[model samples]
Target: ELSGQWLAHVIQTMRLTYESLTALEIPNDMLQTIQDLILDLRVRCVMVTLQHTAEEIKRLAEKEDWIVDNEGLTSLPCQFEQCIVRSLQSLKGVLECKPGEASVFQQPKTQEEVCQLSIHIMQIFVHCLEQLSAKPDADVDTAHLSMDVSSPDLFGSIHEDISLTSEQRLLIVLSNCCYLERHTFLNIAEHFEKHNFQGIEKITQVSMASLKELDQRLFENYIELKADPIVGSLEPGIYAGYFDWKDCLPPTGVRNYLKEALVNIIAVHAEVFTISKELVPRVLSKVVEAVSEELSRLMQCVSSFSKNGALQARLEICALRDTVAVHLTSESKSSFKQALEALPQLSSGADKKLLEELLNKFKSSMHLQLTCFQAAAPPMMKT
Candidate 1:
């Protein structure tokens, strides 16, 4: 059942015992526990962590100087095969049998019996590892290197009486486990530096002298793009009708939507990069100021299409002022009506709340201006 990151964590911490003789199992443990251990070992083998397990064992052996044989094995004080056989005998105490257990050495009769034997084999393997690490010198003779064995491989040659079932085959594979040889390998991972700095690079690339020029260029380009003219739908233009030309513009005569647009542009920039949100307001205020100043220059010109637009605008204003004078003299309300209707309709297309508020303020201001202008007319007419 163990898999993924949790199993990886376990693997990271697990240490394997090398240069040890196989030994006996602990008493009174369940048969299922041994089976589970074998299954776990099989999982490790399939994942090729047995190679890593060998590396860990080799690491431990090098630290202890346990390597002694021509065959790269620990010089055991006692016979390794005898030790394994003894361990298997001890592990059989877990089985609920009568005083003398006889079936431990014999070929297993059933699949269940085979499973029971396999579990005990795994238990013996584990026990031998513990004994080898704990008491390497107790029975092991330092004078002799490797012990004489009929089969040199850990589990020896398997003399199978019959072809094993798939499950039995798996258990057979697990029996030998991963045999650890005592040769040393350079673990470069131990020397690797830790990566604690999130996404930021720990090293800087360019020198201070070079960085200044690059930073200046970047800043200048950003300013140029941001401070470009606020044209298109936001600008006021001369809307021509079939009969007369209406000079339509927002009363405040500034691009009210540009502030929101600039803010959104900043927000998107922050989204696309690892930027501090706290820096956005400062950058935004500067950008808004620069862009607002650039856009304000357009207010001086009346029509976007003409170079003499400002002159024509002056003439129009003069004409309006004269009309105002005449209206004041005659007590007329026509000029006031035209000015009110000439302003853009915010209710139709202005989606932003700021624009709605600006529109309301403009309405109130224009209304007040016209009302005051008309109120003064009766007096001028009397005069």
Candidate 2:
């Protein structure tokens, strides 16, 4: 407590020094410059120091009238709500300030940086939730508490400069709200439900925007990546030389690269996919469709390197399977050979057994392709 007081005094002293520049009869331009620097220092200090989950930050936020919007937040249990809400209200002030065009500090944070900060804030909420959930006798069903946000005394000096727009900060707020913990998330979703609003919908909309940007990047770099790579057969037949088949699949791991971008964008934004009144299926389908479409486009540029088509692929499959059988046959797990031989493949294509000398080349795992004659699979359970 004494240390907290000392910290408060330190902040107050800095404020006094900030205000004292005017008494020095400094030029108005010079005063604004110093004030901007002071505000930056103050904001950085508050954000860093107030990160503790102790009562100090909550007390400070409460005492300074720093909270204002607290309708559904009451769902938070008292033990958990204090620090989370306090942290949220403390951070919210940064989003509230709106300055006229053409002011100062360093350049403002870009949209990506803002989203990253938003994600960090939500991570704190998740931590709080998990902390309470882990307690042996914790009761969460009846837990209800309230939170609010407004500017506080310590943070009063911090305001947006010319660089940040209110609209941009609002986006950050929405992004942060999209990832509330389960109970609070349900409360907020219920609010959204009443208003016909969907957080998942908004998140998907934002995701599509990002996807468009990535698509544009891919389109611009199409010629450079040579979307069309020449493919061929190792068997002595084709004359497509100078073209490497290894480059055929988007430089390796491109599918994962693109999927990872979308996954990262949504990871911090949606806590669970199953907790939706009407948004889960829509969101999942959209995600799968988007990836499938992009990957299909990439796949179009790929063709079989096998010069011999299905005949070649099936022969290779048979050879690979037979090899696994021979290596494991000598081991104590001898029944593995019978199981391996039963695997269905193009039965008419090639001999099931491989030559004894060929066993050395079969050190790798066998690959199997399963087919369903049905166009669509039936549900595992009755609807």
Candidate 3:
């Protein structure tokens, strides 16, 4: 079944049987019975083909590397797409007879059959995708279980291993889903139209809707995984060394947390761009927006800002703003602006000079990180 040779042979034999049955001058009633049986057989073949496709996709998904990278640094359609295409090709060969080739009974019904098959194929693909990306059930509550604190390193190693594996699986799924939604599925729909398949609109709409919903959910999961840690560092970084926003000295430069956040953000930018340049802008935009909003909330909650503390806060925010300047969406920009407005305005010429110097420093650092990110990207994607 996986080889598809059996399917091709069966289809050819059925075609021959239909032709022979028609040529024999068999009675109309007997002919109808034979035609029905052949049609049933064809339907069974289609079902088997769909089942094989689903199984193939699941098999590929279980592998450590589901995305088949044929060329170094060049994004390719995933193995799942190939599986679907192969199945479609096989079905097309059997279901779509050329002009003057279809049997009398099959002629009038070919378009409708093709349409129904197309929808079924799409449903199978979507079902397989959902299964491939489904998260594992939540772990049983471990709080009640006593911990072996003495084996801290062992426990840490196991946790890290599991986390890394889960992250890689998620990356594979998202990259593949993005490619399918943006490229493969559109091409498939176009092919269906070229074949004059009925129900193309509904098929395309339902499949696209499902893919898009999955894509969005995957994106949100990714953002949470990547951005949460960066956002999580905000409060600690802000209050590092017991630094009080209400009683700090004049700003010297951007704080360590701001620097750390920028570094982490750049790293994520590089990782995502390397994986799929198509995902770079949107993913980075969301991550930056999330971090900015969190920063805004944190600053707003501060009871009061000392004169110097406010100056320091403005400096840090400006540095952050400049660092992610390229990736900022309107929402993130608004968040940053709001956070800045909450700070005491810096009117002193010296304060302005200090802020300028800090901004330049952070911008320089950001430029360096971006340079590294560009270098890491594929040559074709450098633009």
Candidate 4:
């Protein structure tokens, strides 16, 4: 059943993509009405896909019912699912009527109409997820999940039935809401942060830039920027002001867990955005920490095993660990250099000497202890 659903969604997405491409080629004035229709259908398709994807995730979670029962599996995606649903549910009244040959259909009179028409297709795509699995009417509490479909006015009463992915759907809803009431984006961002939805937190962070398009409306919404000290001082330019991806640090100090999650998110953005220098060090530090921790764990596990080939595997693990550790050392060389450079400048000669001694102790440990352990391991096993 799951396989069939997956195939169906994939096929639908392909169909919509093809159709949208076709509309893109048609002359703007000649294809205005038809384009709106195509866009709406595409949105419906995206929603269907989101709903199905959410269902598949839920099915897998259910298959591991024992683990889920003992330690509840997260149902956070469902709330995102509903947000998409409400986005579509709110688009009902806003129809994309293409002006007849003599009609002024190509241009929208108000910003609201422009938003409704532009975002129509994407919203349909996200809302289609409702078909994936039956969802409860009441809310569920799960970490990193939030639903802000409470105010019908928030969506402005359109409730169209287009399909869209949760991401694309959220983008469409955000675009329209930001156009109508820029404050809505700020309010939603605050709400999601308070609730701890990291995914939405990142989304809202990027969407805040949409307000820069509005005149004085941008300053009016600046009140919401007061929440995050890190982002509050962000420069008010297109690239820096609202869409500044650098502000995405997870609020965690524990090195291991924080690094792992934060690094993955950074890697994803790096692939997408060609990340700026401001984002590079913060994310690279996390990546370095995560890789080191994983290597350490693998070596410890390999060290304890006594089975055939275990000795060889331990040696291979040691080599990998050394390689990662070296990479980290090289990346953090500047910090190491700064500390070493400050040693001679200390006012207290005795304190400076003590610091030098501690530095020498670290260098000796790295060479004597770590090198000896690596050498003691068996040779690497040939694959």
Candidate 1 local distance difference test against the native: 0.30
lDDT top scorer = 3
Stretch of 10 with least lDDT, candidate 2: 365-374
State each candidate's clash count: 7, 7, 0, 37
lDDT tens per residue, model 4, 1-383: 33423443544564455467565786665455654554454344434444543454344323211111011112223333344444333332222222232211233332233233323322332233222222232221221211223343474322323232232222222233323233444444454344322345345444443333332332223212211221222122212323222233321112222223333433333321221222223333434444434334333333232221232232222333332343345534443333223222334555445444544443354453233122224667999
Among all windows of 10 consecutive residues in model 1, the one with the lowest summed lDDT is 181-190
lDDT of each: 0.30, 0.32, 0.67, 0.33
Predicted candidate 2 versus true structure: per-residue lDDT over 246-333, tens digit per residue: 3332111112232233333243123221122122222323333332333333333335442223222323333423322222223312
Order of quality (lDDT) = 3, 4, 2, 1
Q: Which of candidates 1 and 3 is the stronger one according to TM-score?
A: 3
Give every collision pair in model 3.
Answer: none
Give the Cα RMSD of candidate 2: 21.1
Alpha carbon lDDT at 186, candidate 2? 42
Q: Which stretches of candidate 3 lie over 4 Å from their true place?
A: 1-44, 63-78, 96-120, 123-165, 191-196, 364-367, 370-383
Q: Estimate each model's TM-score.
A: 0.22, 0.27, 0.74, 0.22
List model 1 lDDT by residue over 49-149, tens digit each.
32332233333322322332323233221233333333223232222222222222232232233333333332333344433333433443332223224
lDDT accuracy of residue 172 in candidate 3 = 51
lDDT of 1 at 310: 29
Candidate 4 residue-wise lDDT at 247 = 34
Task: Quote the lDDT for 25 in model 4.
Answer: 82
